[model samples]
Target: MSTVAVIGASGLLGRALVRELGTCAGWRIVPTAYRRVQGDTVALDIRDAAAVAAFVERVRPDAIVLAAAERRPDVCQHDPAAARALNVDAVRTVASAARQCGAWVLSISTDYVFDGSAPPYRIDDPPAPLNAYGLSKLDGERALLQSNPFGCVLRLPLLYGPVLDWSESAVTSLVPAVVASQAAGARPAPMDAWATRYPTYTPDVAYVIRAMLEQHAKGQAVCGIAQWSGDEPMTKFDIAVRIARALSIDARLEAQTASADATPRPRDCHLDSSQLDALGIGRRTPFDVAIGEVLSAWPAPTPSS
Candidate 1:
């Protein structure tokens, strides 16, 4: 009899969350989409406060998962205002509306909030974002917490899984590029080797969210911020090698130092999920296994004859 609304139901993580949560018994999943509508997902523009407030008021969901955000770091760098509008302002709007409706909010955040100086970050680590995207997300987290004291913030690292588009996720984006390079005999395509990333699977994240929601429904105190990361750390080059090996393609990828790039990024933002582990609410699927599952489900592009 409980209703849960998933905003940004069309994106990579959004879709996975909808799929995972929909399977749970005794829950009504209300999926909202913008720009793209799939199945019964309602179209929504979270940036429009009136529209969001109206939707939340109408749906009156018991819980709202704020999964939509302007996530691309480069995009945020180019237009910080746009990022703030969605990442920060919209979060406040949603949290405020959720508070009014007596609905708990769960906002998705990123590990980018930390600078590369730190290796594995804990829940209480002070955030020093290197990019506008990170700053905006951190702001969103603050807004969500301030607006709804009982709300939760889940910080995630690089994620990959069934994506609406191949280039949507940083992790899966490497697959198409490597595939193209192999077809064209382009050995050693330049990839970032300077920074390390913990690539998590979206399905695993969805599973964690479901578990947390179940606990909350059972009157468990699951509020506050928590981190979830993949089991291992790997550079972009390392990921490309794994992708190539998984697909039986040539592993021709070169390493490009991240520091050489003009844009600043966290060199290492591996998150510590010990808190989530202690709560017994999250699981970390191995990177290789997760990647293989994604590839099995992905409709890979065929090489031109």
Candidate 2:
């Protein structure tokens, strides 16, 4: 049984990691939380260097998976400084600490690192992020690589999954809203004409992380800049329609709003997992299948308190 400390284990990817790893490898998952949650919760504030170091030293985990980040695009745009503090600086502290402890760190990253000028971007493609959130994640990736030679950065795309139960984003908010709207016979507005992006299921990503950990432990020469995402590419509009369709709702109720009318989004944030496929490292889940799984896994929403 390996000792893995999954920071932000309460988040989407974190929860999936705990659930998947808990059952498979008998991994003693120490799910760190700033607020609180079940199982070995720790008051870990990644931004605090001394505190981060202290947590790492005390835990002495064999592997550290840093999934904590300020993932909100609008919020990052509103406050780039805060985004940097949490996304980049905090990640640096954790990576540095993990390096000192000789623990392999796999920092969860984003596809937004690219400017989205191209589609199906390969791992070797140069990144030119168009948004603050993307920039911060890019910074985190660079910092981790430079800080620790053994560190791995797994870049991801638009993510969706069961963890939406606690998420505050529109993706998370929209599912329940759409379900309610359909239940109420009202059409919920869905944003169409937004950029095309690769949407990755959180559970599939968790599996890839476990695979990476297993491979890395065996001292394999795995690429650090690996991309983990769905098999096919689709726009937000398409994603919304699919989600509605999965629920057997009139997907037409999903409105088509343009990117101009919505928040800042990359025009083409789709990534290429071919490199991962070539190396036999990353796992690919079909987008449609992923949507069905996500919807199926979503717990029945309750009335607002």
Top model number, TM-score: 1
Each prediction's TM-score versus the true structure:
0.96, 0.89
Could you give the C-alpha RMSD of every candidate to the true structure, in order shown? 1.5, 2.6
Highest lDDT among the candidates is held by which one? 1
On the 0 to 100 scale, the lDDT of residue 38 in model 2 is 60
* Candidate 1 lDDT, 79-151, residue by residue in tens: 9999999999999999999999988889999999999787789999899999999999999999999999879
**Model 2 CA deviation exceeding 4 Å by range:** 164-170, 180-188, 221-223, 254-257, 261-263, 298-305
Model 1 TM-score, 2 decimals: 0.96
lDDT of 1 at 300: 69
